[model samples]
Target: MPRSTFHRILSPLLLWRLRHINDRVYLILMSVLVGLAAGLAAVLLKTSVHGAQQLLYSWVPEEKRVFALFLYPIIGVALTVLFTRYFLGGTLSRGIGPVIYNIARQNSIVPRSKMYSQLVTSFLTVTFGGSAGLEAPISVTGSALGSNLARILRVSRRERRLLVGCGAAAGVAAIFNSPIAGVLFAVEVVLSELSAPFFIPLLISSATATVVSKGLYEGQPFVLITNSWPVQAIPFYVMLGLGTALLSVYMLRVYFRADDFFERWPGTFRKVVLGGLALGLLVFLFPPLYGEGYNIVQALLAGKPEQLTDSSIFSVYRDENVWILLLVATASMLLKVFATCITVGAGGNGGMFGSSLFTGALGGFVFARLINLSGLYPISEVHFIVLGMAGTLAGVVHAPLTAIFLIAEITGGYALFVPLMLVTSSSYLISRYFEPYSVYTRKLVQKGVIVHADRDRGLFAQLDPLSMVQTDFMPIHPESTLGDLVTVFRHSTRSIFPVVDAEQQLVGLVTVDTIRDALFDDEHYNTIRVADLMAPPPAIIEPGDSLLDTLGSMDQHGAWALPVVNKGKYVGFILKSAILAGYRRQLLKESE
Candidate 1:
């Protein structure tokens, strides 16, 4: 069936049912459904990636697993690029930026295919050592589910955006099994607001998703346990917070530098192949940077600093160097940033969530080890590891609340909550002072985009000038008579007609207001021409004019509508009625 034919048949049924159901009730119900689906997606993605990683790595001998891990990243990332370019049009993005962009510009409507695309692509990327996280990709998949369902259901734009947020919250909760962090993440990153109406729905969605996740997967306390912080550790915690804040700054800079490096690669194939090679070199040398590096994090928390020490390529080459382990631990922070940037910039997939976790673990371990080496106050490396995760996350994501709650929830205790808050708050403030936007939103804020949440500029930015144009206006030749213009008006309901030359160039406009006397005088019928009765328009709208500027022109001329011109040809009339309606709708949504 044709799209027009489909819409013709589907629209009435949608509107009929839409009117019957209370919108609030419908949204609450949809939020639960969206949460279930998003939770399922997260579970599926996690299982798929774990399966693929196991299957691929199982083929390698255990003795050479470290060495062979280097090649896996290259193969996984390059194959992802090939599949994307050849089969998926290379348009599938594995990040939250596009989600934000859509909500801002496209009214929260996403392509239906995005519901699965990120899952497939990100699974391939992370499973084979893309050094990226699945959390962002899963959120994107859930967001698509919510957005496309809204498109199918023909929901209002405002409601659609909220559904998208619910989906994101569900994805995050399901992945981490932390509903509070999930809601906070949705508010800080996706929704960009904390409206009361959006809160209950987002909370319910996240809680539901967490329940689904726990129902399917046995919930394990996230960690290797360690002793609680000592009273003497307070000063050390403050110093570590300052250190993590500085490391966070360095990590952010390193990420963009790596992205810039990969972006400059000339050819698509060269980009993928070369980027993979660089990542492979890092993995070959460091070994622990091979995947998400979670096993290494586990090792660090378990008091086996020897795990990273042995895997350090520096140790492999320069044996018995006491400082080599600490050097490698510090270097992993920078190398992980590079590997992650290469993964995404070279067209692999995944996000900063996993990368930050790995880097923070390294930073924490390094800090404690250095402190002990200095013969100062001793700190538990395990406890510091948790703090490091929150601190780095707070800086990289610019959401201190999310970072704090994530650590607190996952640990199932507030034993580390005080330090977590201290580090995260300091890191977030410092990061904001230096780099205001998170990795996800840097480009968006710089470009002045909207998230359907901006009240002043976003509303106007979203209303496309071309979409508001009424193009059905009839054009009368300038040399034609007033009788000719009258005949044109008889068949058309519009009061305004453009006077065009032989080439259809708009020369003047004739309105019912200006031709009242001519219409009453039938005696001067053929004696008058369109050119005599038509007047030069007080204002004209060009195709590229913004809503604010265009509306300002109309206001200045005291006109309700204006003729649209593109290049030198007449297009149509852009009515203040349409512009005002769009503005009012956006205003109400923003205020809500």
Candidate 2:
């Protein structure tokens, strides 16, 4: 109770408390910064894409507005093919993984070179009437921003990885102008885990990114839907959900198959040229099928059925154009899928998120129109638009929560929450039940990446701690004399060793540092028992317990090594070197 004793006791506790606070504050502030960058990056990318579209359109003669339908795609494909092949060499992956690849492996590679290539390619794809979106690529840019910044700041490895997720979430939030949805996207899709450790940073980044994204585009989702359906039509959401699920699976399959087919082509330029030519030909038929398909969605929501109903073939026709557009949409969806698959498969630069949405919307439109005509409780086409978007996303990405929330936020209405939930969940369940893998995971699996949690562990939570533990271990007897132990320690390179009783019952551990002083004194060395030199109550882990627990215990005890024990017997000892090696291997495997 004396002042000296109180000071001695309180100082260590205070220091410990300060360190904890500092770590938490550091992670929070970093996450916020990540979010802000993501949001700004998303806006910049979106604006750049829009600007590119404007520039391309301006170059065209007004009389050739329809001609753009054919020419723009050809140009986009040519440019993308050139850039992706000669410059990028095809290391960049679509969607979140390329960036996630950096964080999980390659020491946060960020792919700065690939980012620029994608920007140009995505711009052309969106601007010139290729059916795709900028959402995924934008997030990759944000993630690259966060990873590169963290690398520059010399942030810790674990924190840096978390920041990567933050940046991705922020980018997504900024792109869609939805904060909550962004956070969930990062967690549900990017980080693949949800917990207190990740929640604060991810949330801060998402919120900041949302603010930045909103500041750019009037702060609404890119797609705005306005519909007022009779409450009685709610029941039909079931059929809508079912239709959406079916279409989503079909869409993913078709896209993958097309991609696989096209990838067999002889050369990069040929593939690009053929894909471009095919897209161009489709544009001549239905001008709306070109580029990001935003104009088509806009045209659809306005209910100008003339595009699908007109009879004139080349007059920028109406109703006939709609049918053509529908056929084109279906073809374009298949083409876009193949284009995206080919782009990624053949090493061309792009992201699939946009293409998925484009195809999803088209799928939704067709299904909704069919249901509308069937007199099935008078469902609105707009509802299918929303449901189809969520369903398509859910099936491919396997992130139902992100898909549902994204639809609600982007659509600017919570009214679809119930339906979004029903449809997205069903879509994911059906796709995953049949395939047991999302597009990304399937790719990883094909590359020989053995994932344990491909079924229940979620995408990001698939880290295996047991793989870090070395099965072979060195054992020492507790009854051995200090002199004998010194000789044994001298021949061994391990810094710490598990000491067991003569019967091999668990006892304790001793570090080489502990016996260093006694080595010079011959009498003391010969007299001291191994137990006398050992640190009592060694940190231990059960074989069945998670490596996460082992890591936590080691950190808590400040131990360089932990013993693995079951019942009363010592099983093996985890050398600290093994942990580091395991971390590197696990991360590297994910990156490749």
Candidate 3:
């Protein structure tokens, strides 16, 4: 055989050998492969974003760069949406939403195309200053990698989900080189479970991925280190925590509203034009709002606030007064949300993680400076800036462990663990007060798409009325007499008889119980039509109705079976027994 053909023919044989190996060994081996793949992907994406930034950020004259920042976001959005729509077929959604959704709906199987779609779109998005982070895209890609791999190997759904968690952990770990944070994020946010089976694979994956990412970078540059602060500043950190919580609510409110508006904007062409133009205009006025805004965090930690303000529209007022600095930082936090909303709402790819980090940094800067100005105590703004990142991340994601460890691992060491825990806990508690769901789960909760967390709920979500619809129920026309319904019941043991219109659309449901009173009075049975004996179906189900809603309808009517209708046409019946079986099956699967 030719060399290329020989390898191709040998690959599946190797996979077969690996497949029959000890299950534990096979899992560990596959996790290593997934970790390497995810790590490499994470590194390449970072490099690509940097590369694009280097080219775009260098476009303007050194003295006049602010003037050019506006053009890039629009350019990035247009090209991204254009390529996603016309060239890439369609873009995979970024972040934890799609990952969780796929796990629940598709047996943890993601399409093969997601592996690169996120990489390409997110690179373009964050590169051209699309005010979002690459974490979401990385998360999407990593989950896809694991899912597709599992599918290729024909793993069980449970094992497939485990691999997906491994991929997610590896992706996060690879980017920040924080294995512990990566594992926490996988459990707290992506997998939404802290089971023992998941812990081993996730830990191994994150550690291996960290090694790969660390080796590839040689010396990673984004490690966030800061100066030490006094223990008495815990009170100050407490206030900062509260501020982050409030900011979290503000951002989530703004984000979902923008999401709703842009959802109605329609068509890829319009989203690119309007969303891109809006983001561009925002960036033009607020130069620091460009891209992921990690540069701003670095500037704050280094006590170089001038670097951030130097290019903003407020540059003329830069650092002239402490109040001016506070005002600018505060305004930047608010505008960062606006720019991010435009970036994501307008169909751009990215996550809220970057924006939350930037916003927290600003909050911390404002807090530190204001306290210093009071002449009461001089707290280290760097400490506050670093703590602020964790606090805001905790509030936004409602995953305090992930936030705390991520900040601790990246910020040199855990010397500030006390303050970190205090701030993260407070932020998470306060944010969870009014807004119970995190950014990823908010839409899912509203749409009832978040059925995976609860066994009963997940089972309900898995049972499609269409799939459960039993077509054996005998249906009669409205014009048919009760005698016809009698014949239906005699031939069929089912208690529910559906009366349809001339076109075979359900008009009403006649139960055996209701007609029993009239059946014995048979003198008028021939004269009475099926419609006369029928009650409005106690439970009527439609083909794409939410499973929870369908269950609610059934419960409300005290029905064991509901007639399924699609656009007024009778489809079939979904029995309560089928739903029971679905719950049993899902519960068994989970236990196994």
Judged by TM-score, which candidate is best? 3
For each candidate in turn, give its C-alpha RMSD to the true structure in angstroms.
6.4, 12.2, 3.0
Full ranking by lDDT: 3, 1, 2
Better of 1 and 3 by TM-score: 3
Instruction: Report the lDDT tens digits of candidate 3 across residue range 1-592.
Output: 6868966886897688766887778888788888999999999998878877888767778667876787888888877877788767775466788788777767788778889988888888899889998887887788899988877666677889999989999998998899999999888887777777778889999998899988877645345554455778878888988988898888888877888888787787777787788888888777778999988888888788876677777787777776777777888888888898898777678899878888888888888888888998888878888888889899988899999899889877488888999999999999999788888887777755763367567767655557778998888888888777777788997888888888988899888888888877678869998878888887678887876677787788888888889899999888877877877887787666
Q: For residues 98-192, write the lDDT of model 2, one tens digit per residue.
A: 55445443555576664465566666556666655677777777777778667655567667778888888887888777788888877766666
Query: Could you arrange the candidates by TM-score from highest to lowest?
Result: 3, 1, 2
Model 2 lDDT on a 0 to 1 scale:
0.67
lDDT of 1 by residue, 456-498 (tens): 6777877777889998999989999988888888999999889
TM-score against native, each model: 0.79, 0.70, 0.91
The count of residue-pair clashes in candidate 1 stands at: 1
Quick one: RMSD of model 2? Answer: 12.2
How far does residue 470 in candidate 1 sit from its true spot (Å)? 12
Pairwise lDDT winner, candidates 1 and 2:
1
